[model samples]
Target chain A: MDYDYIDRLLERYWKCETSLKEESELRTFFSKSDMPKRFLPYKDLFVYQQIQKTVGLGSDFDVRVLSKIEPPVVKAKRLTMFVRIKPFLRAAAAVALIVLCGNITERSYFADDKLDYNYKDYKDTFHDPEVAYKKVSSALMMLSEEIKKSKSQHFPDSLYQNDLDSVCTK
Target chain B: MHEFSFQDDILPLKDKLFRLALRITMDRAEAEDVVEEAMVRVWEKRESYSNYDSVEAFCLVVTKNLALDMSQKKDAQNLSLDESMAESEMDESDPYHQLANNEKLKLIHRLINELPERQRLVMQLRDIEGESYKKIALVMNITEAQVKIDIFRARQKVKQRFLEIDGYGL
Candidate 1:
């Protein structure tokens, strides 16, 4: 049990003079159970460093990290007949929607055409020409009265003409 | 150009990246999150991985930056190590020895954690993960000489504090 080499390597290790391999040797030497009493104080440090090497994430760590880094490998889900036809199903749905919409629109348009045809077959509510002429005259007279009231409430045409003349004179 | 497969190449680095993240954040959950984000970030740039000299080094850099950022955001730099998480697989027949060893392991963890960020990271990358100086320097964005300096200072501080604690116990 000569520990001269280990002691020297330890000394060099403290001085940062040992190579990585030499430092590794010191670690291996300290890892043994039968360490010299003089080296006991420092043994824990080396052994702890060795143990720290094992301070890794759990077995699930790889799974967790790979899930993040590997991009969820989108395992080509064994495309069942249903899955295989998914795109076609989507297209078929879109086409069915379009056809349904088209049918509804066409039916609505036909209903509108029927309404238009009914309008073309319209009959006058007033049957007699004399009664129709009297109603038209009264409606025209009321419209003219309303128009005259609105026009009077606003600027009169004579006033507007005076303002325009003033501006022209100016 | 070596074809870098995510499963074959990058996925395998998870444990190493986890350990690095765990070292920085001192929170298993936060560390896991950082590692996940780093892996996803690297995977996103998988197309440009060939442009880099070493994808592994690039991944380490990404993990380090992400861990540092998260730890800073949470202000978890001074958080205590989760003793339960550090359970070693070593089967010690004697309960007394196991308790003593566990105590020593805790002290060692605290000592390492108390180190300055750069020194702690350098020591972790070098002594624990068995990374080369070149790789560590690349990951830390420092010179190889600076990596060596930090590691030396880190080792000295750990040893000094370990000795002080052991001395006080006696």
Candidate 2:
């Protein structure tokens, strides 16, 4: 093979006059195993270029780049989702806040009506109506028994017992 | 105007972004971070992406800027300057053919890194990434002619240094 073409191309390449096509041609010629001995240094340069081309990010590079850019993409999806549901969420929150305020206001208004009464007076009474009625009935029965015992000395026991039974039954 | 799909467009460019970032930052973790940051920035501006001529070029610009910024901050902090400088020294070694292929690769990577920032970036975009000079010019904010000149100078530097290393071996 003639060496003149490659030599000329090499000269043009060194002068920065070679086009991309010619430069690539030089690269290809140098890549072949049969490169001329005189062109060995240039081969090394081209080989260096070839090897440098292979110099690249590690395989994890994509993952790293994707990870950096991915969050925003997911965030964009999330932002759209947030935008879609924003009105409903705001309305729901407003409803909840209104309900809470209504409850608080109602309790405050009712609280004023009972301020005149001593709260301690009601503290002694049973809160359940049924339990309070039972306690009153038992207290009256104990008082009647005491009265009947004390009056037994001045009246007939049978008469007092009959009257007490009628009253108790009623 | 094309809608940028992370999976279809941005994700696939990870290797290219990583290579450019790695070349500038010279630290794998930092490069990964720069690429990730660039991806995030691109995604954030996704709505405005159609305003540009090319998404890939825009992304390259962003990654290059971010990597440059991060490296500058790293230098300011002086957090691990000694270790980083040591690593940089290793990367700046000359490329000699007598060395193993892997060693040559490492040496050339260092050599390229040793170039001026503009030359280094142009070399990476044009030679290694196989980007068209137009795209490289877009990313670098330079003219097509300037891009060619930068690549030419960078290659010449590599050749000269490479020859020096080989002559030492001889």
Candidate 3:
């Protein structure tokens, strides 16, 4: 298939005379699987021509050189969910914390220890002052005992909730 | 201004720049330095890079200039001939490993390097980089015909060398 022409092209190619298209044709001609023995000698050259397509500096070259360039600029995405919702998440957490602390503090506020219980004041406040005080004191003593027991025994927090419910039911 | 990714417009050219540097300086370390300097020059002066054709070719031209300057300076140092030749061999790494098992192409690649510097440059720019004739002519600052002649001569050399090694298939 135009072997003479290819041979001539090969001759031109060696002397730096052939055009790129001609050289490529020569390569393609030799690239076929059925390249004749007469053409086999030229086969590798064509194959190598194609292979030169892969040649260049090695792979790590970019890594080596670009190491000195500025570190990549990270542009913040205006629409990313995490970024858009970040403020809300923080605010929610802060509100939750404040609410939790306030709830705890409100419970502690009612537990103030400085009660000036004058006998007359106690009498005025109760239908049966002695009986009512005795009942209230006994209930408080029971609650205090349960709290101490739970603290020492490491009871589930549900026990505290239950205690609050039962005692506050009165 | 050239509008493109660092990868698209710049990073991808590393191997080509490396090859150009390696060809001129023939030492990996020195070629690497040249490529870095070239990249810096490109990046720093990129504002002047009008969004015209062939940004890659522009970078390559800059790299070639840098490598050529370095090589010329070293040549001026008047090193011993033996030392200069040895340095040239240092960075001339094999471009064949990238090829498939085609001996013809390997032979041609070697022959292409054996070509005169002008011819080799022509082939590298036109064939290896797939640059357009106009763009390559611009890069080399040569007229289109000179580029064509040089490339033609380079291909002819490769073909001749391949045939000679093949012994005309015995």
Candidate 1 lDDT by residue in tens digits, B1-170: 66668888788888899888877876667778888899889988877766456888889989999998887766555543444234322324423124336877868876787788899999999988998888888889999999999998999998998899888997
Q: What is the lDDT of residue A150 in candidate 2?
A: 84
What is the DockQ of the complex in model 1? 0.43
The numbered model that scores best in lDDT is: 1
Task: Considering the true interface contacts (CA pairs under 8 Å between chains A and B), give the fraction that model 2 also has.
Answer: 0.80
Lowest summed-lDDT stretch of 10 residues in model 2 chain A? A70-79
Better model by DockQ: candidate 1 vs candidate 2: 1
Instruction: After superposing candidate 1 on the true structure, give the runs of residues whose Cα lies further than 4 Å from its correct spot.
Output: A72-170, B50-52, B76-101
TM-score to true structure, per model: 0.65, 0.66, 0.56
In model 1 chain A, the worst 10-residue window by lDDT is A70-79
Q: Write the per-residue lDDT of candidate 3 for residues B1-170, one digit (tens) a residue.
A: 43756656788787778777766675667878898888878877777667436677778888888888887888789865358655544433434333433444445655766677777877877666556677778878899888888877776677666667767644
* Interface RMSD over true interface Cα atoms for each candidate: 3.3, 3.4, 3.6
Q: What tier of docking accuracy does candidate 2 attain?
A: acceptable
lDDT of 3 by residue, A1-170 (tens): 87789778877666556665776687678768885567776566556545556546665867766666668889976688898899999999999999999989988998777678676665355687789889999999999999998786686779868988999998
Cα lDDT listed for each candidate: 0.81, 0.80, 0.71
Better of 2 and 3 by DockQ: 2
CAPRI band of model 3? Answer: acceptable
Model 2 misplaced regions, further than 4 Å: A71-170, B79-85, B88-101
Query: Mind giving the per-residue lDDT tens digits that candidate 1 earns over A72-155?
Result: 556655658998899999999999999999999999878756545556778778879998999999999999999998987699
- Model 1 earns a TM-score of 0.65
